[model samples]
Target chain A: MIQISVDEQACNGCGLCVKDCPMNVFEMGSGVSIPRRPENCMGCLSCHEICPAQALEHQGVVPSRRMYISSRVCSMLNRVI
Target chain B: MTKSFIEESQQNFQHDLMFRVEDVPLKCNPPAAELEQTLHGLMQMNGYIIRSLEEIAGRGANAVTFRAGKKFGHEVAKYFQKKDNVEEALRELSYILYGQYSFEPWKPADKDHYIVEENGSTFIYLVFHDCIVRQTLRRIGQEQSGPLCQTLCGYVVGAIEEITGRRAKLEIVHTGPNACLKKVILK
Candidate 1:
């Protein structure tokens, strides 16, 4: 399982990551990208690479995709795997 | 007696002016080294002295934050290595600088590379990252073309340097043609 962590301090609340993500793994809320569906992450790193703030991290036995944003936002896009 | 009175009045005026306004020199524009030097100067002016260069690099942020008072708060700065390694990928560094405009404001439009935002006194968000063009290259492969790589490399390096006044070295970790791997490293 991949653990995605967005650095609150680093995420600037830009919605680019949410827009770039093809899996719909991220969504914009309170000016930040929250992992709406972590399982939906294709591990393509689209969100991770696109994030301007470099605020995403994925830590696990197999690190897949980590998207870090620069702000602390409400997680409104969550859905069960 | 008149001369003495004039001199006293002049002193009183100077003291009053000093109390009324604090003159802080703008040190935003300068080379990386020079900026660090100016930061040191500001610290000394604030009565804190630096002992060595390593100390400056290691804790320069703290010294700067301290001297700027409440006018400036913590801001993040990132650095990258210059090499052609496929393993270590570059990550974007963004953060909010807590405080009012103690330093000059970096306009989001002006910062075409990174997305910069200021939400009142809450924080200033600076978005730093590469876009699809560079990511496409990275995803496709490293040994694709020198011109392409150089251009991409220059963009990423230039963006960070312009923002932080620091130098960075970039490495191309992998070169894949979006097909079967031509070359593979065992690391």
Candidate 2:
């Protein structure tokens, strides 16, 4: 239920994703990161954090909670904008 | 006033600690926003305390938090009816331990085969998407997987121990900005 994409142009073929993914979801394919075992991906987005080029993308995954955003920052923004 | 990102993140939390005190005398209880803000602060403070304890005590912090977490875990266990079946209890426990929006269970593609077995140990993988500790660390620009994480591990083991009367452990598989993977080992 998760779809992963790699931006070929954006990808530097660092293989960091392949190395970082606990599920072994990515594999280096001809100097490009490929979702070789996408089904294994648990949508932890560990690849996203490791990829320096920001080439990986995932769809159909639940978004993380952002309600923890600082109240001070929000209160300041409420007054400014 | 325009809605802030805080409100957008949690629609019910429409205001960031804004209070309406234009009432007769004063209210016995605090406003909903105040209660919510207090909870947010409490969670953040938990993180801060862990980090501070770590700085002062190093590995000693883990022991302190672990004991506290286990105690809290037992306290939480009192609320739930103990199930005779281990798997059934775990299924129920997941509802409380892994919240709907925060920590979520990561099931394999094989829906029927939900629980994974490796090296003769049964495991349930949980993917934490919205962890308060993670948020707190990010707020202070501190790295993740510190001693605070051990508290959660202890909590899980403690809860399972109380509920099922079986010793268990929580293993941190991996961590990331968006999500983290934790494995609950059934012993």
RMSD of each: 21.4, 8.3
**Superposed model 2: Cα runs more than 4 Å off:** A71-81, B1-44, B98-104, B107-112, B116-121
Candidate 2, B54-107: lDDT as tens digits:
999988888888787788787887678777565787766776576532565676
Alpha-carbon runs more than 4 Å astray in model 1: A61-81, B1-187
lDDT against the true structure, each candidate: 0.39, 0.77
lDDT of 2 at B77: 77
Q: After superposition, how far is residue A58 of candidate 1 from its true place, in Å?
A: 1.4
* Residue B163 C-alpha lDDT in model 1: 42
iRMSD for every model: 15.9, 2.5
Candidate 1 displacement at residue B76 in angstroms: 52
For A1-81, candidate 2 gives per-residue lDDT tens digits of 789999999999999998888788888988999998788787778788778999989998777766567677888999999
What tens-digit string does per-residue lDDT give for candidate 1 at B1-187?
Answer: 3568878888777743343356675665566544544543443432222223224554454334323321221122233333222222222222222221011212222235222223421122211222222333343333232333333334433433434444443343322222110111111
- The global Cα lDDT (0 to 1) of model 1 is 0.39
